[model samples]
Target chain A: MTYPKSINNLISNLKNLPGVGEKTAERMALAMIDFDKEKLGSFSDSITDVKDKIRHCLICNNLSEEDECIICKDKTRDSGILCIVDDVRSLMLFEKNNLFNGKYHILKGLISPSNGIDPEDIDIEALINRVEKEKIKELIIAVKPSLEGEATALYIAKRLEPKNITVSKIAHGVPMGADMEYLDAITLRTALFERKKIS
Target chain B: MTYPKSINNLISNLKNLPGVGEKTAERMALAMIDFDKEKLGSFSDSITDVKDKIRHCLICNNLSEEDECIICKDKTRDSGILCIVDDVRSLMLFEKNNLFNGKYHILKGLISPSNGIDPEDIDIEALINRVEKEKIKELIIAVKPSLEGEATALYIAKRLEPKNITVSKIAHGVPMGADMEYLDAITLRTALFERKKIS
Candidate 1:
């Protein structure tokens, strides 16, 4: 049956989200109809608020509400270390694990010639400026192990080579405690090639 | 890292949607931050419009903007045949297939004693009133085959028994073109028990 114009609009808008298809959008629209007016208003307001308030950090280009992101502003985080990631989501992942007590730089995207995205299209220039001006001694590249990710990492490493900065990429291998048999060919090859001399 | 207050709120609200977990919600929130200001505004407006405009049909309890839903308001559909579904999403599924040209009655929910949902909790009374007041000759029970779905269909069938209405439930068996070996035992049993005479 044809839904109301507003309902259809909501469903279409919801379809724009990642992983949401037509059926899932329709289900979400129907579920929203059951929400109370106050809850619906708050939910809608939250969407608008996110768009209005969230902005890129001046230093790292990471998502923030102020001029500088929390990571950049914090005194405890090591200013001598910087982690570069393809997007804010990856930066958040590292933060969630509490594995890196350093500042971050969000590239926003990788260099992909197929998609017409180049080094200039992302925040690469800002990253260079940050590394040149800041007291960062080591730069960690934490991008996905895709072709575009490799290209972006290599480009950044070459650019920072003249500045005498120690640049490194996160290791690629089978995940911790995962079955080696299920690992993909590339991951297995990388794991074997990068095998450490454990004493 | 702790997200901004607004971003965190948006992520929490997104998690309320079906199949969306913490990671999915975070990804959605991050993606939304990349949307242009105009697209973001339109998305937020659509949500508010859906909340303000969508309502239940006064006659069949289906979702609508006006007093009657599209199915109930359509003059070309057969008024004598009515399909009763547990929710609007199920009704939309039938409509999407373009197989049913009859009116629809949305029960909104199924009765589950364990969940403390009773007959009065849904739109059962409205279904009875519609059947009595309208020119309904046949009532198609299209609820799911779960315990709650069966109980709801049976209860509705018994309630309409005294009205001389031809109450029929949708067939329960193996899906079309599914292999017998892959089919579950309950489905195979139901398919065998409900086997039709070829004549």
Candidate 2:
């Protein structure tokens, strides 16, 4: 009840984040208190910098330092193939594993109608526009295989079919409701290679 | 492998802490990346602030902004009854429950000979001097019941016995080798209240 006001404020702010409880916040606070001043300052600065400098790529909606992310900027990658993902984190995972040599289109979220997030609310239109403009040869639907994921994939596939692009979803070997990052590199590569087109 | 230098540095630093492994570090790193810029800045600032501004209280070895901690500065607290702890984190647990009304003496570390941490390496001399100079009536050992903890308690007990002040160890109702933070509040309180004198 009588904690230092600044410390209490710090703890309160920390509590707002997911998975961080009071004890965890306190432990983090104590760790912060123990960190060197310059490192702590940089740590604080990094938080704001990521928010201010990082944004959805104008071209693909993936996290980007400029109008487009590094993958979009890299000339070596296949500009004709676009991997559509549910979030920037997936894009990062792909980039980390070097599994995808193509460009990415981050949806930023899924089409969860139950959560009031419809297809129109996400970056589906931008993705469609990108496919049309770029004359993309392949559109890989890397979205999760939940009910919403399936619905979104089908919706995107329907929209892209007329455009003559070869649309496919990653294989179902990844267990349902599992995170893509948890899949080992070999498994992920296999999933990507064994992808099937929607009839 | 090709993460932004700053992001990589942060992940590396986070991974260096105890209990945080590769997956946890990745999760923490992603959380930092996703955190609101302003809040992350504050969290970073607090880390440095804690490292730069916080130091061991001169009287009791507890961390404080000044030479003495709030507990040590309070005229109402029973400084004459020093509560000896192995680390500042343990002292905070007592403070969180408002269990102890006395001032604390943090050893800053435990006595682990294999780890090269001995009684002399900590503030044991300062504690002995405080007992000798002050009208200290009781010295409560709140260290764990591990082999190291028992050794530290016995070592400190021998040192203080000549001064005639009572030396007591927290009760063993707490199962052996249990961390103070994990103990339930009532059990911890009971342990404190039912402490037995060592000398």
Candidate 3:
């Protein structure tokens, strides 16, 4: 499976990307050869630029070029309500949909005992410190709904208990446009348990 | 859908790669942030290195760091039996599987009239020239089985009609480990058409 040094080098580097496998890396490396010099220069420069420029927001662990993320810097967004999420992607998802108009705290990862990840391994301490210092009125757990999500939300809630802040998690139920029969039992149960009454 | 400048730049650049959509590009860019400085540097340098170092092999249009590709330069391989392929990836596939020990002539693309691609758009001229000058005894058209593949192979064969070369195409049949019932109509028909007699 020997290839030319440069081709091999690029292929190997491409494989380090999250979803790219050996075959995909090889295909991508081959595709790059078709790119003109200008495109290649910018592509290469961006890879370096992304690393050199982007850093975690000082306050919320969100991706930012400056000390604080754009959301954190905005004066109008609610600072009293803090949305705790698993990572920046979750924050991005919320932001993209314009679903939440509040401050966010990125935990970086959730607690998964089976996977050896703990609350301490993530940014739980930072979340607690941020909530305390900022005097946030409400804490919303917006992590994914899974065992880890449940554990993380409960842990954060317990931590904020002494501070006497209102802690709540986003509801887990059947999603919009989901087929009822195809829904999982736990989700169905949650959907029924959290059913809203119409006036 | 506003993101930081560097993150947006990298995401847009990543989307240019074949088979990468916006979502996948975002995921890959986000994953790159977890990379250490050394990893990021090497990844960035290699992107530029692949473009700087690799060039088309002078002899067969294969990717190469030198004048000729490794296969074309090898003195031991059978240059008389040249394998004609659509691109370098196809050449690499054959090489990786140890299926061919002969030199490969990359056409770089297939002839697709509907897509406005013609015989002159590919490396057919170089192929014909190679066959005439090198006196290649046999040409194996190892391109994939499709309308474009058929057109490309036939076009090359027509060009070499005056050269008196024994040109043949690779056999198409049912793939190994494939379920007979799940096979598509064209593949099934191809399998039946190319079926061999029992010895």
Encode model 1's per-residue lDDT on B69-177: one tens digit a residue: 8888899999999998887778888988897999988786899999999999985887888888896999999987899999999899899888888999999999998
Q: Write the per-residue lDDT of candidate 3 for residues B91-123, one digit (tens) a residue.
A: 878988899888888886899999999888885
Using Cα atoms, each model's DockQ against the true complex is: 0.69, 0.33, 0.67
Model 1 spans > 4 angstroms off: A111-123, A146-151, A162-164, B111-118
- Candidate 3 lDDT over A89-155, as tens digits, reads 8888998999999999888799999999988899699889888898999999999899999999999
For model 2, residues B1-199, the per-residue Cα lDDT tens digits are: 2555456566666664445677676677677677766677676655545556667678877666787678878998777798888877788789889999988887867778888888888757888888888889998999976778888899899987777789998876777899978889767876788787999
Candidate 2: docking tier:
acceptable
TM-score of chain A of each: 0.92, 0.83, 0.92
Pick the winner on lDDT between candidates 1 and 2. 1
The positional error of residue A133 in candidate 2, measured at the CA in angstroms, is 1.3
Ranking by lDDT: 3, 1, 2
lDDT of 1 at B32: 90
lDDT per residue (tens digit) for residues A143-163 in model 2: 876778888999999987777
TM-score of chain B in each prediction: 0.92, 0.78, 0.91
